[model samples]
Target: VAFAGVMFHLMIGSVYAWSVFTNPIAKQNGWAESSVALAFSIAIFFLGMSAAFMGKVVEKIGPRLTGTIASFLYGTGTIMTGWAIHQNSIWLLYLSYGVIGGLGLGAGYVTPVSTIIKWFPDKRGLATGLAIMGFGFAAMLTGPVAQQLMASVGLEQTFYLLGTFYFVIMLLAAQFIVRPNLALSSITENSISQKKGTRLTRGPELTANQALKTKSFTFLWIM
Candidate 1:
């Protein structure tokens, strides 16, 4: 599950590599750099907004279904971006890459983090760090890959190719993800406590509504 989450996150996180494509896209379509850059900003804005709501959806539906849906939207969005570029319609690009793809990014980003934390109760921090680190480091690899793809196959084709790859990979990863078993989790926790000669302590659990009522939640929301 952890490995699958990391793999899925690695692909979804390539949204950060938008800078690599911005210049190429502008040069190809004779659009202003700032205008092309707005697509990235819009995508990020929707990423945050969708994440706020998608977290609730993930809790209601399992991670597997959520991840699958995210992959579909993200993949379709990427493909639509190719069409937008081919058609030279910036508005289409915004609707495709910004709104649709961003929603997928948010859902995909949260699914793994939430599931991995449950699997690794003994190492929640490390688990989450590893998953998110994939997102953080995605640009390092994707930048070079995108550059090479643009050089070899042109920008529109690059989007098509990448969208196909993301769709297949994310679907495969989602298939392997299942909720952690409560009985198995209890056994694992017991074994870990015995091996470490200490038991882990937990804070009071809160429901979604209860969490919203907290001062920290309110402050974070405002910020």
Candidate 2:
């Protein structure tokens, strides 16, 4: 499940590979590089915007549903984007890749982070790094794969193929994600707490309200 989340995130990072598509898409369609760049920027804008909304949604519905929906939307958007390119409809391209696909990217981004945190309360930093590390390296893998696919299949078919691949991998990841049992969690927490002094606090703990009210928290959030 965690790895699924990682894959979802890595694919989102794969957007960095979009630049590879730019010269090809532009040469084929006669679109300006600046214009294509705008589309990419819009997609990134929506990715961040949609993530803010999806974060709460993930908490409510859980990673499985979130991952499934993200995969479907992202996959569909990629296929639609390919069709849009074939038809030379910039509006359709933006609507599919920039809006719909961006939404999926955002939802998938949060899924694994929340899940990994829940699974490894004691090693949150490690869990977070594990979940997010793929994002940093995604471009390395996706860039060449996308280039090869575009070269062999053409842009339209490449989108279709990549979309299908993302759909399968993301869906599989979501399916394997299981919520850790809270009973086991309590037992572990209790055992760890016993090892500490009379104070039962597990590391540093704070209520959400308390955290939000803190100057450092507010500063960090602002930063």
Candidate 3:
């Protein structure tokens, strides 16, 4: 259930569902369909670009920071997209949903996979599979939700409602999705043991360059 929550939070925020908002935005603005499509393409570009860096950042700073930042970025992006409507500035839409929101998507995308794997080490595959499943279903949920909210509140207000909902849910998931402490302790213990064994048998200190030149090292590198 915990794993499911993580997946739902991350995947539900996916930009795939952004298509649902496109027709309405274009119809209201009297813009061409092609122009609306461009927004999605740009947003996808940002999603891919941000994903490359966000994964490493997650590893370095941890999931909480990554998730928190993602929520803020995504939430602000949604709000800004709505603001773009009020202002009729297409560029603002791209900047918010395409750049900032995509960065959030990338960060949220990776956090749960690694953290959940550690939590359920024996069922890593299942954990990963379930986590991504929510992402796929997010669009299904978003489409109807978008329609209902649009009818009741209109486009501008719909963005605000979705933005606020995603922010709160994602923040909660980030706060609760913690890395297992045992993993760190185990790695530390192993490193200490390696250092202790090396201390007594210090025959010769080979630099990294020197080690690289050795036949055994060369063989291992090939493998």
Candidate 4:
């Protein structure tokens, strides 16, 4: 699950590579850089919005379905971005890359972390951090590749190729993220409770009088 989560993050983190397209899209379409940049902003906006609603959805449907849906939406959106650019339609770009792709991003972003959390209830923080590590490095991993693709094949083709590539990788990764059966619900719960109790209550207790008699308390009284 953690590995799947990493792969999911790696592909979706390509969102961070939006800057690679800004100038190329602007120049190719004869649009302002600001205009081209708006697609990225819109993508991010929908990403937040979709993520807000999709958390509950992930709880209900599970990550596999949600992750598959994300792959479809993102893959389609990326291809549409290429078509939109070829048509010189800014609105289409906004609709495809921004709204549709962002929705995919939201689903992909939540699926792995939530699923991993379920699998590793005790080490949720570590699971979440490990899952998301790919997102941080995605820009470094994908940025230069995108630049090279653009330089070689031109803008629209790059989007098409990348979209196809992302779709395959994300789809493959999504398969590995099966939610745990959870038939051992009671045991899992007990394990989590025991672990938490061990961590929080392991220290020796201090009586109230003994605490008050400490040197720190004396300094406070003087102040």
Q: For residues 1-223, what per-residue lDDT tens digits would candidate 3 score against the true structure? A: 3563455455445578877888888989877777877877876677678776776787799878777887888788887888987778788877887777777777777777767776665467888778877877777778887889999999999888888888888877788777778967466555656767752233578876898899988899799
Stretches of candidate 4 off by over 4 Å are 192-223
Question: Which of candidates 2 and 4 reaches a greater lDDT?
Answer: 4
Which model is ahead, 2 or 4, in terms of TM-score? Answer: 2
What TM-score does model 4 achieve against the real structure? Answer: 0.85
- Give the range where candidate 2 is weakest over 10 consecutive residues by summed lDDT: 195-204
Candidate 2: tens digits of C-alpha lDDT, residues 51-147: 8778788778877898899889888887887988899888887888888888877877777787887777678788878878887788899889988
* lDDT value for model 2: 0.80
C-alpha TM-scores of all predictions = 0.91, 0.89, 0.78, 0.85
- How many clashes would you count in candidate 4? 0
Please report, in order, the local distance difference test score of every candidate based on alpha carbons.
0.91, 0.80, 0.75, 0.90
The C-alpha stretches of model 3 lying farther than 4 A from their native spots are: 1-14, 183-223
lDDT of 4 by residue, 70-144 (tens): 999898899999999999999999999999999999999999988898888768899999888998889997889
Looking at model 4, the pairs that clash are none
Number of the predicted model whose lDDT against the real structure is largest: 1
Better of 1 and 4 by lDDT: 1
Candidate 2 lDDT at 201 equals 56
Candidate 1 accuracy as lDDT: 0.91
